[model samples]
Structures are given as structure tokens and as C-alpha cells.
Target: MTVMKSVPEAAYGILLRNQCDSALDEAVEQVRNLGYAVLNSGYSDIELQAISDQFDSARERYVDAYGEAKLRSIDEYHSVRSPLTHGGGVFLNLAMNGNLLSVLKKLIPGKFILNQQNCVINPPQENYNQGAWHRDLPYQHFVSTQPIAINALFCVDDFTSENGATFVLPASHKAEAFPSAAYVRKNAVQLEAEAGSFLLLDCMLFHAGGFNRSQSVRRAVNHVYNIPYFKQQINIPNNMQGADLSPEMKEILGFDYMEPASIADYLLTREAKKY
Candidate 1:
């Protein structure tokens, strides 16, 4: 969201530095100019740094638990890619998926969920060839006229053109249909940024990972935000529901006192049912 158009970009930037909130208008402009904008910001540099540190830690630990080979298919540029591309992940189980949904209920206090089940990814083959190229959640929600997912790709390392940074087809969301590989081959834009820089791409944009021949590792975290009407790639309210939620787990799911009626509801609702 944006703060206000009347607020000078300088003021807005200051506000951003001080956690000044954005108005939807400012957000719209940011989106128009940069394709995406920061919604809410944290405190100091150390605070934001800590968030990335913890996020990276979680990723490495998870990889340790699940062998790199197991998720290799996910990192592929073509083919099945990420199961989340179709809605599945390492957190597919009942207890694990359930606990997560419950806690989102609280932090957001409504029904916003992180849907971490679909968050896993391993990266391309060590050789790092150019990707097949595609879009993120190109599918539209039944209710939305536009592409449903607002994608945030968090850089886990300094992204460079040589090391397979993710690429985006600028303004592809407005395209009526996905382009042929030949078209993407003709013109594709890479999104290169420093580690800690978050690139938000319109989910509909045709995209892929560039080849990475560098010795350094390339890593990233992508979060897809969508409205409730779209079919979720991963089922959030799957096996666990009802009273199965622990209080702490519910807090994480953003669920307070009730089980979500549907997976979509569990993920998109910002206003929880009031007691």
C-alpha cells in the first residue's frame, strides 16, 4: 500500500525509513513504476537484517532435513518445477500443515496464511543452464480479473546476471496470454539485485532463471500472495482441522479460536470472525 500522493516521495521515503505506513494509492504508484512496492517495513537495519538471517537459517535447516536430491526437480526451470506450481511441498502432512494455518490466524488476526507448504525449492543442477521460462501462478482466480498472485522473490545471495538471477518479462501480466518460448527467447529481462533486495514481480509475467556457471551458490525465497478464490496449489486445511490446533500453532497460522472453513479462507481473510 502507498502512503499518499500528496506526501512527497522524500517524505514517503522517510516514512518508509521510520516505518511510515503506505496508503493504497502510494502502493499503486509503486506498483506502476517498480512492478511492486514494500507494504510494511520493520525497524532498524539490524532488525531487517535479523529477519533475513532467520529466514535463511530456516531454509538451510530444512534442506539439511530433506536431501538436496529430493527437491532437485523443483529447482528445474521447466517440467514440474515446484510442486507449489501445482500445489504440494515437504510440509504436505496433516500435523505440520495444520499447525501453520492455525497460527497465521493470529498474527494477521483474520485468516492470512503463509502457505509455507509450497515454499520449498533446491536450485538448478550445479552446471546451471538457462531456464525453460514460465510465469508464477499464471492461473487466475475465479473472481479476479487480473493475475491473482503478487509475487515477492527474496534474494538469498547477491543476485547477478552471471549467477542465474530470476528474470521477469516486464509488464507481461497485461498480456492476454502466455507467449511462446520463441517470443520469450527474443526478449527477456533479468532481475538482478543485492542479497536482501526483494524483487516483486507481477505473477503473470513470463519468467525464468538464467544460467549460473559461477562457483558461488545462488539462492532465493519466493512468496506468492493470492486472493481466496483461486485454487491453492497446496491445500492448507487438508488433514488437520477443528480442535486439533495448539494455541502456539494457531498463533502462527493466524487462527485464533476457530478452524478455517476452507483453505482459501484460511489464507486470504484479514478479518477474523469476532467472538
Candidate 2:
């Protein structure tokens, strides 16, 4: 004779297995319930160093290309946009990490696009543009049944109280309107995490970068991944044309979701096109 557990018992066992099998289940749940979560990327010291170096080089190259005056004039200073186009392999590798992707897959169903990837630097004791509270999907004031996008910010340096770490209003993703100032003051939490850890948040969550009171600058790489229904911040497939990328990465970057040029093109399958 054999015995089978009840439905609730079986479900509990499956959930336990999922939690144990992947270290990210709890973190994912936190993001679902609280609008944010901190996740470790599990990269080695040497790898994290490479990523840091890449971030510095990318920012320098961007400044050189655009000129500091031009960047400041446009209010885009200290930020490197689309670093993956010019950054080293480490940047791309971090974007394609299996663990991070796994957490994303759990949160967002179906195909998603890399809306944008940029490097942000917070200067010590200086007022930065991102210091104010805002949602990643700015200007939108509605709540969705599920997350439309996720922001995975990789901390290049250890995020500390002195070095501007991120701060968020917990569970604000469920609220359609921003909370009162008094509520924010009481509920806001500063997230301090080690280098190489990701400060993951729902795109709708209201978050801001804390002021860096330390003597050193703090750097972070931000990646916004959203469902393909929304347009990318930049035309990634067109911008990174001729660049070598794995098939999965290509699809994730919106290669498969690009709009067709003509009726014939529209009729063709995604694979048949040369995009």
C-alpha cells in the first residue's frame, strides 16, 4: 500500500524545494510583497573588480565622447548610457548572469526587454539628479496586477550609510499615489548592501539615491528590464548591430520583438528577418 499527501501538504513541499533549490525565492517574494529586495550576485572578488574597472572606463569614454560641458548642459552628467555597447565583456556577462535572470523570470512572465542599462555615479557630498524620490517608470500613476518592469542596480562599491546607498518606501508599489511626507519620513529605509549585490526593485516603487556623505564617490550600474510591450529607452538591436551576442541575449534585448518594416516583413517570422 502507498499513501499520497494532501494538496496543501504537496504544495508546501514543492515550495520548500523551490526555496532550497534556489537562494533567490525568498528575495523574489520580498520584491513581490515589499516592492524591493537585496540579492547577492555571487561574483568572485576578481570578477567584481573587473566590473568596477569597466564602469570607470565606460564613464570616462562617455564623457570624452560627449564632453563634460555638453553632458552637464543636458543634465546627463556622471551617467553612462548604454554602457553595454562600449563596455567590456564583464558588463555583458553581469547582465546575462543566470541567477539574476532566474529571479527576473519569476517576477516577469513571458519575454522581457532590457529597456536601458546605464552607469550612475554619486559624488561625495554633492547633490545628484537622482537624489529625489521617483519611480523608474516615471509619470505613471497606476498599479498593475504584476510588475511591468524590474530595476537591478549592481553596486560597484560597498553601499554604506556614508556612501550614498539607495532608499525606498516599503510596499509603495501597491499604492497608486505617493505617500504623505510624514509617512515617508517614518517608513523610508536606507538599503545598505555589499559590493556585487543587487538592489532590486519594482519599477513602480518610489526610490531615491541617498546623498554620499563619504569622501569617496559611489558608483552603480542600473539595468531596467521590462516586458516587450513597452518601447526600449534606446534601440538596442539597432545600436548594437554587428555586435556578437548569444541568441538568448539577443532576444532579451528586443531583437525578436522589433517592429516589421513592411507588410512582407511583418508576415515573415522573427527568425526569417536579418534584424
Candidate 3:
């Protein structure tokens, strides 16, 4: 093994001084280097309460529609998949929050799409689908030059050790392969954050939900935003048709990139983009 030594006089003061100038800069830097960052969702207490209530109702609605047995067959029992389909304007607003979007704009560059949004409820003392270590992209083992996707998990309840907050392997996004079992055991970190905070993660990060030891369920809404080339978990534009949507909202929700019905339809869109 080669021994390593540091240079005694290397300069790092200017790098430290210029590192992060604002909250946004800090958040971006943390997510880039550490693979995750916690940010205030910027929703007021009343709004947070509203989101919690809405998520509860939406989860119930989904459970009723799908039935527990069917959902369990797919390993998604208590989770609400695509709550936005029934969550009304409140969910829409959360998806379009300016604070979250500003961070996304810096991280994603030109454009990104809402790939999926779901409400995940970690029942006290029970298993959830998210317990396994996996990337938000799933089944992929490559690192992008830049982030291809991001996960903004909005905490609907306080995430705590007692309640089983998320566990993350720091800097795992920068690795092309999963670390050794011993390394994971030594390095896995559980993040605790208050309600109404967004746990921002690079989609490539290796992470999992911890087992809830508290007496109450812990809930969060997870939104995965990805580059437009990736297919969405649900066809958002189709599901959201007839709902009043701004041009910008429509574009972000992927209205602009839907597959065309025919060659003629494809040509029409291609021609329209020319101007």
C-alpha cells in the first residue's frame, strides 16, 4: 500500500470563503456533495396542516378504489400512488412550489418533468416498500455527469429516530456500485427533519426508510422530478386533462412532450417548435 501525505502549505481559504453565499447555494452544494439536503418547504403551519389532511384523505380514497388486497399484491398497500389525481389544487400547488422549483431549476438546468408523486405512510412497527436500499431511479447503477433526476420528499409529520426517519448512505450517488455491507453498516445515516421540510435527494443516492418504532404512523409526500427523456410513473398529462393548468405548469407536468398519435400529429408538434 502507498502511504499518503498532505501538502503542508496548500491554500484552501479562498475556496472556503467562496463556497456558499446563500441558503440556496448551501442546499445545492449539500445535495451535490453529500447526496441530500433538508430545506424548509416554505408552507405555513396552516398549509402544512392542510397538506397532511389532504394526504390522509387521498390515501384513503386510493385504498378504497384499489382495495387493500390488490395494493398488497403490488407491495403498495398503505401508500397513495399519484395522489395528485384526486388531491385537487392543494397537491398541484405543492408540486409547483416556487421555493422547491427554484432549487430544481438550478440543479436540473433547462427543463425537468414531474415523473411521479406519491404519499408514503410508514406505519408504526410495520414494513413498507421503501425499506430496501435503492435509488429513486431503481435498477440503475451508473452515475450521470449531472443529476438526471431528483427526489423532494416533503415531510408531512416530524421525522425522528423514534418514528423512523429516512436512512441514507452519504456520497453514494457518486459511486457506480453499492458499497460493501460493512461499509454500509458503518456509514448509513438516518436523517431527522421537522414537518414541512423537504428532504432533497439526488435520485442516484442509495437510501431507504427506517422502521418506525413510534406508536403513530409517519407520513411524507415524495415527488420524483426527472429529465424529460425518462417516462413518468404515471402519465400525468392524461390523468390531469380538463383540469385548469397554466402553460408553465402544463409543460412541467409533461403536457408538451406527450407521445403523438400519428406521424401527422408528430410532424405538427415538430413544426410548431420551429417558431
Candidate 4:
């Protein structure tokens, strides 16, 4: 996949409003090219506000449940939202339709996993500074891969330049690994999008959460989707059974009535194979 030469956000909305698959294809291409992309859609102020309340309630529940993690030192490191949510986010998953998941699946194929990541950030007070630059996908994990891995960043709070919005290197997904030691030849950019902007990024791209100079807590949710056969650190383990979903929805969740098969069954025989 290559960087989309044109900005597809406007076209994406136009096409999506019309349910144009062809336009979505173009948008997918565009997302690939840029090495990362952001979709500012399907969210309203009311929606974001509600999500904020959920997070607040979650924090209280987290303290009640985890007990130890509520401590000032321990709670800070709870990047993922599962324990915090008291077993939720999956409901948020259900809110995302299978139609959308199917579209992403077709665009990315057997290379993506759902509900694999989350983040809740609290900036340090009394003059905080930078976070070390890094890529979302580690070096050993990909073992030097070029196919784009995506990390979905959903802003629970408004991502401003003042606050700790994520910064990314556009088109840096081509980089072999996290170029931590190298000096970037160009200026790194901060994604100053508003709340609910789902920032989808290629895992190879170099990025980090910028320093939050604001007083308010800066919260963001990260969902890293990777290619199949790769090691998965986090997974969506929620029970979908009896959930308000159609048969098609379950299929996207890999519940398509699959049977076990041997590796030999999948491979071509030596005699039939063309070397």
C-alpha cells in the first residue's frame, strides 16, 4: 500500500453518506499511503461527553476493584482500560458494527485484531517534559516487516497542542524499526485533533504522546490491530454470545463456524508444487 496522494476525509464522508464502497476503497488506499490516518466521523459532542462520564465512573470502579492499582504510583501505569472499565469497552466494541469491521477486514485482510490496546494518560504536574519517541510495533515483533500495522487512537478528551495529543511522522511507516537513536531529518508533527477523532496509524511510524502542559487529565484510548499470525499481547476477550448482533456480526468476530485443520491440509504437496 502507498500513501494516498489526496486527502480522503472529505471524500470519505461524502462517499460514506452515499454508502459508496468504491470511495471507501480509495480512502483505504489513502490511509495506507500516509502511514497513518484519522477518521473524524460518527461522533458528536454529546457522545464524547457521555464517554467522558463513563471514564470517570470507570476510574472509581477501578479503584474499588483493583484495590492496589488505585495507589498514586500504581494507577499511573494502568495504560489499558479493561480493569478500569470493570469489564466494559466490549460493549463499546458492539457499538462498532460488523459492517465497519468487515470493511476494515477486507481492506487489511487477515492482518488485524480487535480490542488489542487501550491507554489512559495523566500528565505530570510542576513542569512536565517529553516522552521518549518510539514506534507502536516493536522491532522483534515484526522482525523487520513493512506491511502497515495500525494503532487506533480514540481521544476521550479534546486533543490540543497544549494537551498531550499524539504526534506522528507521516509516511514513516516504511521505516524498518523504531528509529530511536536517529535524528529525524524533518519536523515531527502533533495530531491536534478534537475528542473522538479516531487516529489510525501505521505501527512502523514513529510517534509519541506529546507533553501535556495543561492541568486537566489527558485521556486517550489506543487499540492496536495487527496482522494475523503475529503475537498478540492484548485481545478482545469479551463474551459476544447472546449479544444484540446479527449472524454476520459474529462472523467478523471469527465465530464463522470454523473447524480445526492441520497445517499439512493447508500446504500443497511436494509433487503438485511448482518450485
Each model's lDDT: 0.48, 0.90, 0.91, 0.57
lDDT score, residue 83, model 2? 85
- How well does each candidate superpose onto the true structure, as a TM-score? 0.54, 0.90, 0.93, 0.68
**Top model number, TM-score:** 3
* Ranked by TM-score, top first: 3, 2, 4, 1
Q: Which segments of candidate 1 are over 4 A away from where they belong?
A: 1-27, 30-60, 68-130, 138-147, 231-275
- For every candidate in turn, the CA RMSD to the true structure comes to 10.0, 7.1, 4.9, 8.5
The deviation in Å at residue 93 for candidate 2 is: 1.1
Per-residue accuracy of model 2 over 119-208 as CA lDDT, tens digit each:
999999899999999999999899998999999999999999899899999999999999999999999999999999999999999999
Per-prediction tally of clashes:
24, 0, 0, 4
Per-residue lDDT of candidate 4, residues 103-158 (tens digit): 36645655454535445664745222225567776554353334435666777888
Candidate 1: deviation at residue 174, Å?
1.0
Q: Write out the backbone clash pairs for model 3.
A: none
Question: 177, model 2: CA deviation in Å?
Answer: 0.2
Arrange candidates, best lDDT first. 3, 2, 4, 1
Task: Give residue 132's error in model 1 in angstroms.
Answer: 2.9
- lDDT of model 3 at position 129: 79
**Residue-level lDDT tens digits of model 3 in 1-275:** 99899768556546444367778878988898889999887899999999988988888888888899999998888688788877767888989988899899888878899999988989999988788899998889999878889999999999999998999999999999989999999999999999999999999999999999999999999999998999889999999999999999999999998999999999999999999
The residue ranges of model 4 lying beyond 4 angstroms of the native Cα positions read 1-27, 68-78, 83-91, 94-103, 124-130, 141-148, 180-182, 238-275
Model 1's TM-score against the true structure: 0.54
